[model samples]
Target: MNLLGRGALAPAVPVFRVFGAMNARAPSASLAPDVASRTALAVHNIEVVYDHVVLVLKGVSLEVPEGSIVTLLGANGAGKTTTLKAISNLLHAERGEVTKGSITFYGEEVHRLSPNELVRRGCIQVMEGRRCFAHLTVEENLLTGAFTRKDGRAAIQADLEMVYSYFPRLKERRRSLAGYTSGGEQQMCAIGRALMARPRLVLLDEPSMGLAPQLVEEIFEIVDQLNRNEKVTFLVAEQNTNVALRYARYGYILENGRVVLDGPAEALRDNEDVKEFYLGLSATGRKSFRDIKSYKRRKRWL
Candidate 1:
C-alpha cells in the first residue's frame, strides 16, 4: 500500500511550520564544547519570512552531532517548531520562506531539498501532536510511515515487530483505532510511526507535551534509549526544559527566534542565568532557603 496514495496515513499536520522570535542575549562560553566538532545537522544563520515580509526566525544557528541527542528549549512561539519546518522545507500556509541561511544534513545542504526528498534522504520528523490516524489501527499507522520505501514485506513486518518491542503497549493495541488509545500511547504510536521510516536523524518536537509526569519520563527514556542503543541522532524542540535537558547531551536555548545560548547539557543544567530564567529557578535565594530550614532543624535537634 503506497502510504501517500491512500492519504489515510499522510502526516495530518504540516511536518514543519516553525515561526516566532526570542529575546536577544550574548552567547555564553560554558555552552560551547572544547572537543573537535562533529555535526550531523547544522543550521547556519537561517532566517524565515512569512508572506515575504514578516520575519519569524532570525539568524538561528545550532548543530547536532552524530549519534547524540540535542535539544532546543524555548517558550511558546519561540520559533522552535519553525526551525524544524525550515529543515523539512514544509513552510507553507504561513507562506513561510527561508530568506537567509542554510540547513546542512550529514554534510549535505538540505535547505534546497524538497520535503519528500528530505524524508527519503534519511531525515524524518515526528511532529509535535500525536497525529496518528484516528480511524486506522496501530499496525496500519506504523506501515504508513514506511510508505516511502519499497522493501519486502518481511522487512516491514520485522520493523513493525521491533516497534512493538520498543513500545509494548502499541502491540497490545495494534488492532485498536489510534483515537481510542491514551495520550501517551498515541505519542508512542507517533514515534513508532516515524521509526518505520528508518531515519538517520529524527527531529522530535515536544514529545512530552500533554502527558502525565510518569508518561513524560517514559517518553524521555525512550528518546535516550534510541540515542544510546540505536545510534540514531536527534534534534528535539521542547517546552519542558528539565526533561529535555536531562536526556540531551547538548542543548540550544532559543529566545526570540535566535540562538541565545548553546552548550553542553551539563553546563546548561548549572548556569546561573539559565537557571534563573529558562528553568525558573530563584537565583537570589535558591539554596539559602533550604540552608536556613536545615539550620533551624539542626538547632532544634541539638
Candidate 2:
C-alpha cells in the first residue's frame, strides 16, 4: 500500500501530513546560493534648514551602490535639489545648515568637510542652470575644474581628451566662448568641468531642464554611458521622470521635503502612484491606452 493512502484510504490524515512536510523540505534543500555584496553608498537620516527658520529636508534616507545611477524626482519646490545640496555640502556655503543627522561618503563623515575638501576627496556638484563663465573659452572653463590638481600639463591634457571623447560636441566648440554656444553645448561644458575633478560621484542638478528634446536625449545618453563604462556614480534631481528613470538604476520620490516613495527604476516605472503624480499621468481619467498615448504625443510636441 502506498503511504499516500492509495489502497483503501489507509490513514489519510497521517499520509497527507507526511507528504506536505516532504514537499516543504524539498524546496528548502534546493535553496538559492548566497550572493556576493555590491558596494553601496548610504545616506542616513538627514535634515536641512535654511536661515534657522525654514526647514527643507526632513529625515531623508537613501542609498546608491557603486556603479549605479540614482535619481531624486520631485515637482517644483519639493526639496529635491536641497537634498542634493546637503549631500554635497553646498548648503553650508549659503549658510543653510544640516541641522540634524550626519552624511557618510563611502562610510566616512561628509557633513564636516568643506566644499573644496570634498571635491579633492572625490565628490563634486554640477549646479543647475549650467553656470559657466560665459566669456571664457571652452578649454579655459574645463581647466578651471582642475585647479585643485598640481599635476603637469600633459596629464591635464589627457583628461581633457577623455572628456572630449565623452562629449564630442564640446571638442567642436573647444575654442569658442561658452556664451556663444547653444544651451545644450553649455550644459555639456558644465558636466565636463565636473568630470575634470576626477570625482567618483557627481551630484547633477536639473541637467535636462530648459533644453530641447534632442539635446535632452543626448545628455541623458552620455550620463548613462558614464555610469556603465566609467563607473561614475550619479545623484540627479530632475523634474522629467520619464527621462530620469530611463537612466537611473534607483530613484527616490520627494514631495514637500519628504521622501514619499522610493525603489528600483524598474519598480517605479510600473508604480501607479508614481505615474499619477510625478510622471504627470491622470489618475482618474477614463481614457483608453490609445488616448493616453495620443496625449503624451501632444505633450512632446508642446
Candidate 3:
C-alpha cells in the first residue's frame, strides 16, 4: 500500500537515521530586493539529530537561487534526503530535529514552521520515490495538493489545467488510478501534484530514480521548462550527476553528511574528481571509490 494515503499526502514523510552540528542563524523579516541577492532557500550550518542523540548533518550549508536549478549530488547514506527533509520541516515526522543552525526561505526563518506551513510558504518537496495515491485517480491526486490553498475555484482550475499542460501524459491518464500507472506517469503525477500548489520553490528528490534515461530526460526538460517559464526554483537531490548537472545551474556534492565539493554545474562537470570518481572516466579506466587506494580525503568537509 502507498504509505502516505490517497491524496496530497501520499508521499509520507521519509523515515531515516540522521548524522552533524553547526553554528546558528538569526531570523530576519525583511525581504528587500537586491541585484546582488538571489537566494531563495538557505540552509545555514545546520545540524540534525535523531532520537536526540545520533547526529546526521555537520555544519552543512548551501544556497538555492530564486530562479535557477540547483543539484545536490551524493551516494547512499550521504544525508541528501535528510537535508531535504530538514528544509521541508518534515524531520519531525520521523522523530528528528535540526539541533542547531537556521533554515530560511526568502529571508524568513522557516525551520520553525510545520511541513504544511512550509508548503503554504511556497516551498514543497517531491519525495525520492514516485509516491502517489494508489486508490485515487490521477486528477484527484492532483487536487489534494490544493488542500492548503484558500484560493477561489477559478484559480484552482487554471492551476489544474496548467499541471495538465505541463504533464500531458497525466491529462491522458487523468481517470486512471495512480497505482495503475507506469513509473514515469506516477513520477509525473508526483511532480504535477506539487505544481498544483503553485510553489515558488520545489525540492525535487530523485526524480530520475527507477526510470529510463529517455524518460529522465523528458522529465528534466519539463522541470527546466517550468523553471524558465514559471520561474520556479528547484533544489534537486539526485545521484544521477550526468542528468542533474545538465539541468542545474550549480551543484553541491555531499558525502557522509557534509558538502565535499561545490561549484557551477558546468565547472563541476569538468572537475577531475567528479569526472574520475563520479562520472567513472578515470585515465586508468573506470574505478570504484572502494578500489582507489590513493583517493585520500582532500579536506575534512567541516
Best by TM-score: 3
Q: If both were scored by lDDT, which would come out higher, candidate 2 or candidate 3? A: 3
Decreasing lDDT order of the candidates = 3, 1, 2
All models: lDDT?
0.77, 0.75, 0.80
Give per-model CA RMSD: 10.5, 16.2, 7.9
- lDDT for 37 in candidate 1 is 42
- lDDT string, candidate 1, 237-298, tens digits: 99888889988888888755767676788877787656755565656645433443433422
What's the lDDT for residue 27 in model 2? 18
Which tens-of-lDDT digit does each residue in 155-242 have in candidate 2?
8889999999999999999999999988999999999999988888989999998999888999999998887787788889999899
- How well does candidate 2 score on lDDT at residue 220? 92
> Which pairs clash in model 3?
18-56, 19-55, 19-56, 19-57, 20-56, 20-57, 20-58
What would you estimate as the lDDT of candidate 3? 0.80
The residue-by-residue lDDT of candidate 3 on 130-185, one tens digit each, is: 78989999999999988788898899999999999999999999998999999999
Better of 2 and 3 by TM-score: 3
- The candidate that wins on lDDT is 3
For model 1, what is the C-alpha lDDT against the true structure? 0.77
Off by over 4 Å in 3: 1-37, 283-291, 296-302
